[model samples]
Target: MTAAQYLNCLQGVMQREWLRFFQQRSRFLSALVRPLLWLLVFAAGFRAALGVSIIPPYSTYITYETYILPGLCCMILLFNGMQGSLSMVYDREMGSMRVLLMSPLPRPFLLLCKLLATALVSLIQVYAFLAIAWCFDIRPPLWGLLAAAPALLLAALLLSSLGLLLSNGIRQLENFAGVMNFVIFPLFFLSSALYPLWKMRESSEWLYWLCALNPFTHAVELVRFALYQQFNLTALLVCLGLWLLFSLAAVLTFNPQRAAVRG
Candidate 1:
């Protein structure tokens, strides 16, 4: 496709996702509520029990809520990423995806546009959660929020790509709930979302290594550092690499022939 045509296709994909997002107001509310509950209720309960030592991106002791705020922000992206994939499944079943794929635009470009549009929507939720956290005094620096935008977007891209990759393998909507449980719970619970890696190490060495190797862990770390106006070369590199790898895999595995047969 020509540059102008490609831009038009991109705009349409984004507009579709944006309209779907607002049309489902409950989806928006639940996305905010899940993390807010963690920030307000769960974090409050754990604040006294969990003592965070001075860690990188942190110069002094910080509350548990403060430490997990980045993770909760990532949580918003994580859920929305999978939710985007769920919509893809629904679209395919309804024949809308086939129509999208039939466009003259290259499949990879079309898929990338879809991924980015979903990431943009996910960022809206992430920032909303961050704003709520700030009100609760779990604030990162104002400048950090600004600096973290690219990091958050990268993380959103990585997770959204991963979600698309998984969805490409799923042939039916009926099985998506199990897939979500298997993917989301393990990725979240096994990562540094709720606790630091060092704390996990104190409990079990193997579990710590699992958290270390999780891409979501790096995503959260990337956000954590960026939220403090700090740069983490390792986290940035990991997230970028995962984003490219997963996006490529998703595009490759998203076979229109197979989808046609299945449908």
Candidate 2:
């Protein structure tokens, strides 16, 4: 395809994904409600139980809610990414993916476009969550909001790429729920999402290292620091590196024929 055609394809896919997302209003509300429930109901109990120390992106103690905000933002990306990939499974089964994957453009570029579409949608849900968090007094600086955009987008790509890679291997939609539970919950709970890494270290050394190794942890840290108008080199590097790795793998292995055969 020509450059203009490529751009048009990208735009078309993104617009289509966005329309589908907005049409399913419940999907949007559930995306917001999941994080809000944690912030509104669980934060209070966790805040009293767990004390946060001064950490990067924070000059002093912060509430548990503040610490988990970035994690929750990542959560939005994680779920959306998985949902996007789940749609891939649906499209493949319904025969649409065969058409999409057969385009003249490189399959990798097309998949990248799909990932970006998912990222754009995830970013919207994330911003909406942040806006709602603002009403509850979890305000970060206004500038920080702008700073977070790039980081959030990067994290979205990273998490979405992971889902894409996983989706390529999944032959059926029904099995995806079990796979999502396996991947998502472990990534969320084992990382620095709800608590600091240092706190994890105090409890268990191996657990701390595992959390540190989690790409989701790096993604969370990347978002957390950006939301405070700060930079985290390690987190940025880890997230970007893993995104490249996952995207490349997803693109190489995005074989709908394999899924169709296995199904």
Alpha-carbon runs more than 4 Å astray in model 2: 258-263
Compared with the true structure, what per-residue lDDT tens digits does model 1 show for residues 158-217?
999999999999989999999999999999999998999999999999999999999999
Candidate 2 on 1-263: residue-level lDDT in tens?
A: 58999999999989989999999999999999999998889997889888888878899888889889999999899899889999988888787887786778887888999999999999999999999999999988889999999999999999999999999999888999999999999999999988899999999999999999999999999999999999999999999999999999998887756534343
Output the TM-score of candidate 2.
0.97
Cα lDDT of candidate 1 equals 0.93
Best by lDDT: 1
Could you tell me the lDDT of residue 50 within candidate 2?
Answer: 88
Candidates in order: C-alpha RMSD to true structure: 1.2, 1.6
Residue 69 of candidate 1: its Cα lDDT? 92
Weakest 10 consecutive residues, lDDT, candidate 2? 254-263
Query: Lowest-scoring 10 consecutive residues by lDDT in candidate 1?
Result: 254-263
CA lDDT, candidate 2, residue 248? 92
How far off is residue 240 in model 2, in Å? 0.7
